[model samples]
Target: MYLKHFGLSELPFRITPDTSFVFANRQHQEALNTLLMALQEGEGFIKITGEVGSGKTLLCRRLLQSLGNEWSTAYLPNPSLDPDTLFLAIAEELGVKDAVGLDHFHLVRRINRALLDVARAKKRVVVCIDEVQAMPLPTLEALRLLSNLETEKRKLVQIVLFGQPELDERLRRPEIRQLLQRITFHCRLQGVEKLEIGNYVEHRLRVGGYRGDALFTPGALRALFRASSGMPRLINILAHKAMLSAFGEGVGRIDVKHIRLASKDTEGAKSLRWFWF
Candidate 1:
């Protein structure tokens, strides 16, 4: 609503996981580099863990887009499926049109064939599962078994899991320890650091097509960092609200008062009043 008022072409502070707005901050860049290197090595199972709103989904999408040609990617954003449904979803993603009603045996057979077909074309297939903590234990075991389908040289299908810290706890179970061991590469993602908050906001603002001077004052920037505690999603929330607060007052630049008002209205941000005072 305030895009024109702020001389922006798009919403700068949206919480959606759009890759175009992906800030190449330290943590995000490190995580992406790690993932790309591991995949290039043809690692079978890779794990990426981060806290909620830490940008795992966005990272996953960015990785998929970066794979370019020579790689076929399948994304499962929701990992709550049962073992049977999970297999069916993989099969469908691999181009098996009739994956819905197939039995477990048929589903596995189809997925295996699909993987081999992709490999024959000299292209690697990667399956990315998001929110993997919600996947059933049986489904995870099935996933491990699926990873076993491979040629003598390298695995036919590689899997990358993006999830919250609970996924690490889930991997500690006795039944799932084997799966944990299969993770050839693992990376943990952290939120934006305080010192990088200004760059982060400016980066997104530039991506959103703002060519004007600094939109947020120094005091507002400090308040924003303290209020969000370095978390990306929270920063977006607070920043968006602060911009709205500024727009309401017919101001172009966000000030400390606007951030304080935004923080007061946000759930976790209220405790940041100490920062304001």
Candidate 2:
């Protein structure tokens, strides 16, 4: 709604994980680097954990986009499937069309054949599972067994897990200890630091095609950082609402008052203790 008023080509704060709007903030860049290195090393399992709204999905998308053609990627955005269905999903992703009607044991063979075909092409296969905390424990063990498929040289497929902290708790369970042990690399995503909030806002604004002068005043930026607690999603929500409030008042710049109102209006940011004042 404030695009024209702010001289922006599009809404900069949409929650969708668009890689084009990805900001290479320190945490994100490092996560991507770690993923690349682990995958290159042919590591069997990689785990990345972050709090809700900490940009895990965005990082996942950016990593998928950055991977070269040498890597074949299978993405499982929803991990609610049972082990049997999970196998079929991977089969479908790997282009095993005939796996749909096959039984569980037969489906595993089908997937193994597909992986071998991919290996013969000198390409690596990567399976990325998001929200893995929701996946059942049996399915997770199945994933571990699937990871056991390997040639003498390296693993046949690598798995990357993108999830919230609950996934860590799940991994700690005695039944899933083997899967946890197989994870060769791990990275934790954190909120932007206080010092980086300004740059973070400017980065997203520029990436979203804001070409005009500063839209948010210094005081407003500081307010935003406090209100959002440096979480990217909360930052986006507060910033968007702040801009909308400014636009509604026919103002050209956002000030502290606008940020305060924006923070109060946002359900998530309202949980910040100072907002109750």
TM-score quality measure for candidate 2: 0.96
Q: Which candidate is the best by TM-score?
A: 1
Q: How many backbone clashes does candidate 2 have?
A: 0
Per-candidate Cα RMSD to the true structure, in Å, reads 1.3, 1.8
Who wins the lDDT comparison?
Answer: 1
Q: Residues 1-277, candidate 1: write the lDDT tens digits.
A: 8999999999988999998888888999999999999999999999999988889999999999999799998999999999998888888788888777878888888888888889999899999999999999999999999999999999999999999999999999999899999998999988898889999999999999999999999888888888888889989999999999889889899998888888889877645656653
CA RMSD (A), model 1:
1.3
Off by over 4 Å in 1: none
List model 2 lDDT by residue over 164-206, tens digit each. Answer: 9999999999998999999989999997877788788887889
lDDT of 2 at 144: 99
The reply for model 2, stretches above 4 Å from the true place, is 270-277
TM-score of each model, paired residue for residue: 0.96, 0.96
Q: Candidate 2 at residue 193, lDDT?
A: 79
